[model samples]
Structures are given as structure tokens and as C-alpha cells.
Target: MGRRLRRAGRRAPAVAANADGRLEVFALAPGGSALHHRWQEAPGGAWAAAWQPFGTAAGGAPRVVRDGSGRLTVAAPAPSGVAVFHRRQTVPSGGWGEWQHLFGWSDAAPALAPSADGRLEAFALSPGGARLVHRWYADPAGTWAAAREFGEPGAPLAATPTAAADATGRIHVFAVTADGRIRTRVQERPSGGSGPWNAFGERLVAPLPAGTPAC
Candidate 1:
């Protein structure tokens, strides 16, 4: 039978498995006051006794992804919504570092996906929701590339984006347009660069609320 894992806030939790294969969950506290975390005591085993505070003053649900080196990193928007912050495990399946400012002026929480080359890439909606912007780690040293606009110039996104890496290592991003249509873009070559935005070819009966998962 299923058992209660832990009490969580209204925002949906984000989960990822560590290099050692243990599953970890990140959730926002009620009212997005803080980001909380818990994990299996052992790979696929019992849960941690208590939820630990990962970070405070989270603006939205947390997004987690593993770097090429297998270390897990998490990102979340600041409570004021003007910027995003991130923290990374000092080593794979080890302790985490303090939160540090990652980027700014996001309308919602950012989406994270590992690139084919092992770098972690982040995507966020511009303040007006008219464009998507992204940046990537340049190396394991943690150098970040300058943020750049993504998607077509005239096509405005209506909601936050979500991303995932395919088996072949290409990263695909999906977003909802104002008219309830889904659109997507992908990397031309894994971590090489991006391809043109394309219609996903399905219109929803109604617009998906902001932050809805696209894929």
C-alpha cells in the first residue's frame, strides 16, 4: 500500500534521482515561503525522517536536473519574481552549497535540462511572457554563457516552459502560446545550438494555466 511521503505546499514537487540511485524530492513550502527537500535513506528504500529546508523565499516550484558529472542542481525563482537562484551539490550525492543568484527578470520558475555534452541548460520566460531566454554552463567550472532569447521573434509564449533531454541527448523545450497552442524547439546538435521553433500541432480546448507542464 502507498504511504504518505510528506506534507507539501501547493506547488507541485520536482524529483530526480542521485548518482547513487537514491530518489530525492524538492517541494515549495505553503505560500512558496521556502523550498523543502527529502530523499530516500537508501536507494529505493525508506524515506528521510524529516523534510529539510533547501532554500527560503522561493517564488515558485523548484526545478532539478543532474549535471554531466552526476551532481544534482536545483533552481527556483526568488519570491519577488525578479530573479532566479540555484544551488548545486558539492559532489555527486553529497552536500549542497548555499543558494546563489543565477539569473534575473523571470516571469516564472526556470526549466532545467542536461545538454548532450554534460552541461546544464536553463530556460525562463521573459518578464512579459513575450519571449523565452536561456543560458548554459560553459564548463564544469560553472561559467555561464550570456542569456539569449529563444524561439521565433513574433511568437510570444503564454506560459512557463518545460524541457527534457532525449535519449539521443538532444534537449527539447515546449511552451504554450496565448491561443492555447503548444510550440516546441530543440537543439540542432546536443549542446551545439538550437533549431528553429516549430508548431507542436495541437490546440488545447482551453489555455493551460501558467506553469503547467507541457511535456
Candidate 2:
């Protein structure tokens, strides 16, 4: 069986592998007051002795993604749900910079995915969960583009969305709809326009339990 770590968290932890291959974990503190982090001392090795208080994260679990340059960036929503904050490693597998506003108006946790060309893209549900919106870097390690709605304007999501890049480098986003159906949208081209959202797997027999993270 896997051994338990020392600290507790308000939400399930988010994890990612560093450029050096060490495993890092980020978690939200009880009451969603802050974010804490721990990491493997070495690749596939024992975890750090204590959780380090990283930064503020009003609520919801944090999300981490490695940009094309190999730097890790983490983002979380603010308490009011009107903004998101993020921090990035100064260098690949190195120390992180101060937390900075990332832009938002998110009603739920945010999701991130790295583009084929090395740019980073962020996704979140609009204030009422009535639309999915996203923004992406203009270029690898560059400024961000304006946020825009994703998918058809009338469609709504029941929970936070999740995103990942496929082997071919196209990014795909997945979410659960109000009716308990899974839907997905894919990049029509690497680091380019997105295709329309489409139904994914067969409808779930029962809606996922509240707080369950949908793919």
C-alpha cells in the first residue's frame, strides 16, 4: 500500500512531475485559506518532510501545468470567484516566483493545458456555469490573449473542465454537462482554433457525486 503523507487538505491534491522528474503535489488548506506544496526529494524518492505554505488560494483545488519551456505554473481561483492567481517556477525545476493575478471571473476551478507550440492555455467556467471561457499565451513564454468563450454559447457545464494534450499535440477539453453527460472539444489544429464540442461517452447512470472531478 502507498504510505500517507503528513498534512491534510481541503480538496484533492494536484500533482505534476518536474523537469528533473521529481513529483510535486499541491493542495488547498482547510477552509481554502491557502495552498500548500510538497515534493519528492529526488525522482521517485521520498517526499519532503513538511508541506510548505505556498500562497493564497481562496477555494478549490489548484491546477498545475508545465509550459513548453519546462517551467511549472500553478493557478487557483480567488475567494470571490472574480479572479484567478498563478505562480511560475523561475526556471525549469527551480524555485517559484510570487503569486500574480491570472485573470478570471470563474465560478469553478480552472484547468490548464500546454499547447503543441509550447504556449499555455487556461480554461474556466463562466460566473454562472453557463459558458466555458479560455485564454492562451500569444506565444511560448509570451503575453496572454484576451479571454473568449469556448464551445457554443448556449451550452452549459455542470462542473469544472479538464484539459490535456494528445500525442499528436492537439489539446482536448472535457467536461460534464448539467444532464450528466460527458462532452469534449478538441483543437482543430496544433495551438490553433478549437473544434465544436461533442458528446463523449454514453450518459452516466447517475450524475457524478458533487465535487467529483470530471475528465
Which candidate number would show the highest TM-score if scored against the true structure?
Answer: 1
Cα lDDT of model 2 by residue, 97-138, tens digit: 988777667634578889999899988776656767788888
For residue 124, give model 2's deviation from the true position in Å: 0.6
Model 1: what TM-score? Answer: 0.90
lDDT of 2 at 124: 75
- TM-score per candidate, in order? 0.90, 0.88
lDDT of 1: 0.80
lDDT of 1 by residue, 87-143 (tens): 999999999988887878873668888898889998888665776789999897666
Q: Please give the CA lDDT of all the candidate structures.
A: 0.80, 0.78
Off by over 4 Å in 1: 1-9, 209-215
The weakest ten consecutive residues by lDDT in model 1 span 1-10
Error of 1 at 40 (Å): 1.2
